[model samples]
Target: MTNWTRKALLLSVSAAAVAGTLTAAGAPVAHGRPAEPIAPPLAWGPCEPIPGTPVPAGQQCATLRVPLDYRVPGGPGVDLAVTRLRTDRPEARRGTLLVLAGGPGGSGVRRVAQKGGALRAATDGAYDLVGLDPRGVGGSTRANCALPEADRHVVTLRSWPAADGSITENTERSRRTAASCARNGGPVLGSFSSRNQARDIDRLRAALGERKLSVWGHSYGSYVAAVYAQEHPNRVDRLVLDSTGDPDPTRVGYGWMANVGPAVALRFPDFAAWAADPAREAEGLRLARRAEDVEPLFLALARELDREPRESEVPGVPLTGNLLRQALHSSLDSDAGFAPLARLIRSAQDPRGRPALPPGLAGAIPDEDASVMMAVICNDVRWPGPDSGYAGRVAADRARYPLTAGLPANIAPCAFWKYDREPKPVRITDEGPSNVLMVQSLRDPATPLAGALRMRAALGDRARMVTVGQGGHGMYLGNGNACGDRTVSTFLVTGKRPARDSHCPN
Candidate 1:
């Protein structure tokens, strides 16, 4: 449920039918076709008995052994952690509805716990709710790059330049991070592509004894679900893609980072309205007297920080202009994040006190978490290099959208990745079954509405869309938009979709 969900998705689309079972080779599987040969069945047991994350009661867990490299089937296997909340009414149970969580880093086993109750109520026991930790995630076959602690810190990992927006430190760190991953991540890290995750989804379905899967995909999960729908169109039932990003094959993950420029601009007004509201006065969170004054006040503070970085409670790491700007971006992922971000800002502005860092930026990420986050994106598609005029683009993006402070346009380790692209990035086409439904928030800070529209276009008539007039990264159960939630849950339960694009007002 963190702000970002782009984690690991393995496999790439191919032409050959992945019949009998999809080996790691990622043999292309046709849509709707029921392949006879299936993977071994999963051994279901108590999930709460496990240590890490606790699953809800009645939620059972299982482990499926998928090939580390599908291309090399019959080789060593990776344990994919899977969970399911069975229908309360067996007579009403139609099939399994798989929920793919956001984050290349989001843990599906955990997401199932968070949204399980709401989903059961929405579907009225019509389908079982299922989810999994994709490869490289928790409870699954885990992999770590063993990156340096300094490089793993959010402030450093994000490639935010110095206060003045210089790229010197950023460039060195990007290259170093990439080098360490290439040296330490090994094959498991290399195996974290979204295409592969699509294949992994099929394997999960086979293990669950489901001929086809109903999907509720969120954030990066939307892209994974789209890939599965494209590769095995026949194998999908009702597909709900929530908070999707652009399916631009060439840019993939890198483009998503860049789109933050427009995404933040589109959603900042909502935050301004919240920040300047009279209701916030009691909390000492008001940034300005009027909503219009919020933007100027924020920009002024950032510039002042740029000139003079203030020390944070966290040792060594100071509160810089970009850190403040990045905090704003993170807050917009959900309205719930608004108060903490506001408090952080207010603390930073205190002249006599040490500013506190946001939890996300206070410390370095876990090595395995950071590794997969980078591997999945880098493995999915290529990013721009210095030769591509990224500096010029960064300058333009920063000028046009100062709120993002050019971090969106800055280079990432992917720009200097040593590994080659997988079988290639998967392109979403209209050739598959028309089973996909999309729900998007108009003012989402991440995966903006514009990208979701492109995804809508890419799916062609194969998909229908519902636009929720809200401001958040995820719209379904997370954002509490009843119209949007009902629209999606109905499609899952009844397999019916809106005939055309529909808008649900705030």
Candidate 2:
């Protein structure tokens, strides 16, 4: 609980497994799933160990070489760290299932290593599970802005306003941070966009010798999956998009960030209900006598912290209002986050208590890690500049949703970033294969149901959507949503989708 500890937390966030585009003029050449050629045996070997989460014994790792830019396939290439957990029941094996991690910054290798066992069990050994770290992320081709340590911290990167709630500092930080990334991040960094990532996925498919891929792409990964499906339709057998952000082709990443204004409002009540419950008393986390009162209690606390931040276990970095908001944003990703958030609230309220920063926010994120987050979002598409009335938007956002206090709506480095080398963000189309299945949580904060619906709409008749009456970012294999999980797994194993768009009762 020192400043160093908090800094440690930030570095981990940057390193945590968490990344580009193609265009309309060069629209995807019409194609379907590639030929059903047997993928050559992976040079299977033991997986590298990850701290805290051990790799399942069955998992194997390998690397695929992909060009940093698809346009020059003959040019220099980067290694895509790939992982696989083969089916024990090879006789029952269906095909390969690609698992895509969220966070334009998420590490696919780490994600597969983490979820391999449960995925194998859930799919009944139906397919060999495979994952690939995208460029600018873990185990793949890496890049960094070498951003000043001061700017690498998530708190600073998050665009939180000054104590008086002024955006002047935020604007300068945004500009400075953008300038730093552009200066230190070279060609590799410039190539960090969704369009490139999708192309990389296809190249991996070729390397694996899989004709058709069954993919499960979560959160930001869902958008990646959608783009893949659109670009190469026939090559996909079954596509599952879980907990997706809105892919308004025009707005891209910034749109998703702005939508957070309404997203948290939608998901916060669930946290409130949990925090107000009688059962929480056992945990010393009960925050309010009634669920309805939880809103005022939380908003007031944020304002109080804004006025006077409390000292945290980490030195120098006090428990400020935006930090609480940051923790809340992450907590809404699932119900499991409820207790810790409640505990944080309890700590902040205690005069003698010191709040511990959330694991993801306690310290500064890695330079490369922070770079990945910033690069992909900043490069994927263009955003509002100084003339775009961002201050007015932030003011409106803060006025309408005091709980968010404009962090969701504030200007990001992308607003000042240069994306000249970045190709157009993928246009998710309804013309793709009808093999896609989307699962969404009704009350997800990070990727709310509303945004998922936009994705469903974009996919149109090409996809079937299942909305779950739950409260979390990921519904399938997450959030304990049995109905939702079963729905997705059934479709994957049996190839039968719901008759129509449907709801999975909580």
Candidate 3:
């Protein structure tokens, strides 16, 4: 669920953030189809540091040219910015490991730069780490819907419903956003779909001159990775899917959004416990003496802000209930986000104090970034039509899960998107080699355990799952659980997974 909202908020906090058959003429043939030209070798060079992301020392960069549409192999292409951090000990290097960053719009090049060093150490220099900026992301070819500045804000983009659970505003926003993208975003935007992304990965693998590739994918990337594995099962080796969601082809993106409501309910207790701790008193961050009181306090504050939005640090953007709820969703991703959230909550509770908006909520996201995020989800699967009784669903969801306030069920830009008639999403199955390993947090605010279990079930014998007794997204090398990290790291390095499904204590 590294959708626009989560991606934007996470970025604001710290400024964070395949196989082929062969043919003559260096082209690959697939399933009796005519041969398609293989991507040319990438010319690796010194990587330029991406703004707000540190490039690891000695990381090399390159670009791969992939067709905008695979069906038109000789058509205009898009440039994929690629990065690699070669292992220091090439003597022990096994192969190349691709880092699949989360988000349909996540920058894999940035992810490689950020995690290369730690990953190298974790695998004991067993593989060269490499990643690429998926199309419409980072240094790759980008697209824009010419969205209004107001439409680009994370809160607005997320389609948060009105305080009373009315989705009228959301419906209008979704319609216009869809219209804007259709009117402004050309074939480039239309080309951004998960299947295309999976095809892009195969092109990346070929460009790297590897017959097989291992992968480490988290969040939405896990879904992409799974699709790639399903599409090209024989080309994958030592796969690790971290914090994945259900891969219901009919409802790929919609299912993910729907899961957020239940997921947040499960993960909020962790934050409530932390916020109610006696130790937080010294820091002036405690919200309640009892853990049970924290949820009510937060809900009351949100409702109050709903009726009367409070002024925020951002001059023009006031703190509305949806914005506060958005902040809570972002904060619940990790324990580290608790303090800033607590501070914001405390400030909001004060009569005269002005709340400081999270960076993601302070302003609009870049046009291209927003475009890609919207395009991929909308393009992947057809969403419910405007007449799908979204209002009734939102009302029911709001009553069932007050924490999310019906946002998860509200209509989104996808509901009105003009899809390019792309084929349906591939259904993930247990057809692949049994070389996949999965590590999931018991309480991921985004991906959630229920969805992860569905993914695990879909993969069946093709994978083994390690459920981490933790509460956060990204299980490996994230959320600070040694047991989960070790399980995934060991699998990546040694190709030895637990005999079956296992649990890792926090």
The prediction achieving the highest lDDT against the true structure is 3
Question: Residue-wise lDDT of candidate 1 within 1-506, one digit each (tens)?
Answer: 11222222111101000001111235555556746445988788887543344567899888888888876678777888888999998999999999998777778888888889888989999999899998888778877777788877666777766666677788888878777777777777777888889888988888888888899998888989998888888788888999898999987787778777888899999989999999999888988899989899889989988888899998988998877886787778788888988888888788887898876777777777777777788777766764677677777888899897777888778777765433377889999778888999998877888888999999999999999988878889868488998898889889888889999897
Per-model TM against the reference: 0.92, 0.93, 0.94
**How would you encode candidate 2's per-residue C-alpha lDDT over 276-347 as one tens digit per residue?**
899988878999989999989988998899899999999888898888987887777778888888889899
Model 3: pairs clashing at backbone N, Cα or C within 3 Å: none
Model 3, position 42: C-alpha lDDT score? 85
lDDT of 3 at 145: 88
Worst 10 residues of 3 by lDDT: 15-24
- Positional deviation of residue 27's Cα in model 1 after best superposition, in angstroms: 3.3
lDDT of 3 by residue, 341-422 (tens): 9999999988898888887789998888877777777877777889999999998999999998987788887777775454
Candidate 1 residue-pair clash tally: 27
Deviation from native of the Cα of residue 176 in model 1, angstroms: 1.2
TM-score of 3: 0.94
Q: Candidate 2: TM-score?
A: 0.93
- In candidate 1 the C-alpha lDDT for residue 250 amounts to 88
lDDT (Cα, 0-100) at 129 in candidate 3: 95
